[model samples]
Target: MSIIVQNISKSYNKAKAVEAITFEVKEGELFGLIGPDGAGKTTIFRILTTLLLANEGSAIVAGFDVIKDYKAIRDSVGYMPGKFSLYQDLSVEENLTFFATIFGTTIEENYDLIKDIYIQIEPFKTRRAGVLSGGMKQKLALCCALIHKPKVLFLDEPTTGVDPVSRKEFWEMLKRLQQKGITILVSTPYMDEAALCDRIALLQKGSILKIDSPENIIKNYDKVIYDVRTQNMHQLILDLKNYPSQYSVYAFGEYIHYIDKSAGFNPKDLAAYLEKNKHSEIEINISRPTIEDVFMDL
Candidate 1:
């Protein structure tokens, strides 16, 4: 494994941030920590990258212990923090050069590693990092991180605040990097992006709800979810939640995704109930389970 975390725990003051958290990432694999904001994803990344000490637990990254070999781990992994942290006053080329020089390398040494991503922003290489657009800054940050060609890469919410097109492009770049044998551990709040990972660990409230290939996690979900909508969505949700047999009720895109506690759940029964409640244009249909649905259920 390229990364191994066992029973890791951390806290701020007396409040627990993460408790007994554990997971691993294989060499040359693209692994993801999928969760929403405040789910402790950043804390885990900090621990593995040796930036923060865990209150309890052990972690090894790139064949070195996080504590005893902190320096080694720092050199062996490339980390792009959740927030942009590159030298803002410096031009793009300057930022990249600074990172490479600090790592005892140069752009020419690892041009091939970051060529795909760098070229997109090479046209803006003369612009100051602080003035670049969000997507451009993202590309610049990634280029700086890869300038040293580290064996492992850690990206924390790399796509957050990025445009849809740029987000898609970024993931494509990651897929290419994984093909080059770079183990990547990325965290994201977007459930749609989680499907792009080779494997994902679904996390919530500082605990892992499930860990597996995205397909397997969805395939093994035992509940049947229904996509339901009515003319009055707000009232429909309240009514559904109050229903005795309802297991879960939450908004999902154009409809409310509802699951029942009983196996004998019938959509007709629900429609009838809604009709009696004065709801019009009721629509309820069996919906395919998605990563988001599974996360919400867990």
Candidate 2:
């Protein structure tokens, strides 16, 4: 395993950030910690990267213990924090060089590692890091993280504020890096992005709900969801929640995803009930389960 976290727990002033959290990442695999904000993803990242100690449990990163071998782990892994932390006063080239220098290496030594990503920003190499656009800054941050060619890379919500095109490009770059045997552990709130990873851990609150390939996660979900919508979206949700057979009810995009608790439930009965309630243009159809659906169910 490239990363191993066993029963890790952390808290601040008696409030638990994560409790008994556990997972592993295979070498050369692209793994994701999939969840929304405040799901303890960042706390796990900080623990695994040795920035903060867990209140309980152990973790290993890149073949070294996170605590006893903190220095080695720091050297062996590249960390790109959720917030941009690069020197804003430095130009793009300067930032890359500075990171490379800190790692006791040079740009020429690892040019091949960052060539693809760096090329996108090389034309603006003279611009200060603070003034670059979000997408450009993202690429530069990634290049800086990879300048050392570490065995493992930790990206915490790397695409949170990025545009759709840049987010797509960033994931593609990660796929290329994984091909070179760099283990990647990334966290993201965007459920759609979970499908891109080789495997993902679904986290909520401070616990892991499920961990498997995106296909398996969806395939194993034992729920038949229905997409229900009407003229009034808010009222539609309230009505569905009040339905006696409702197992779960929540808004999904333009529709309300509803799961029935009754064994012999029928959509016709639901439509009849809605019609009686004065709802018009009722549309209810069997919908495919997705990562978000599974998370919401959990």
lDDT per residue for candidate 1 within 1-298, as digits (tens), equals 9999999999999888888998889999999999989899999999999999999999999999999999999899999999999999999999999999999999999999999999899999999999999999999999998999999999999999999999999999999999999999999999999999999999988899999999999999999999999999999999999888999999999899999999888899999999999999999999999999999888
lDDT of 2 by residue, 1-298 (tens): 9999999999998888898998999999999999888999999999999999999999999999999999999899999999999999999999999999999999999999999999999999999999999999999999999999999999999999999999999999999999999999999999999999999999988899899999999999988999999998899888898899899999899889999999899999999999999899999999999999999988
Candidate 2 lDDT trough over 10 residues, lowest sum: 236-245
Itemize residue pairs with steric clashes in candidate 1: none
Per-residue lDDT value at 138 in model 1:
96
Q: What value does the lDDT take at residue 260 in candidate 1?
A: 95
* Model 2 misplacement above 4 A: none
Query: How high is the CA lDDT of each candidate model?
Result: 0.95, 0.95
User: Could you tell me how far off, in angstroms, the CA of residue 128 lies in candidate 1 after the best superposition?
Assistant: 0.4
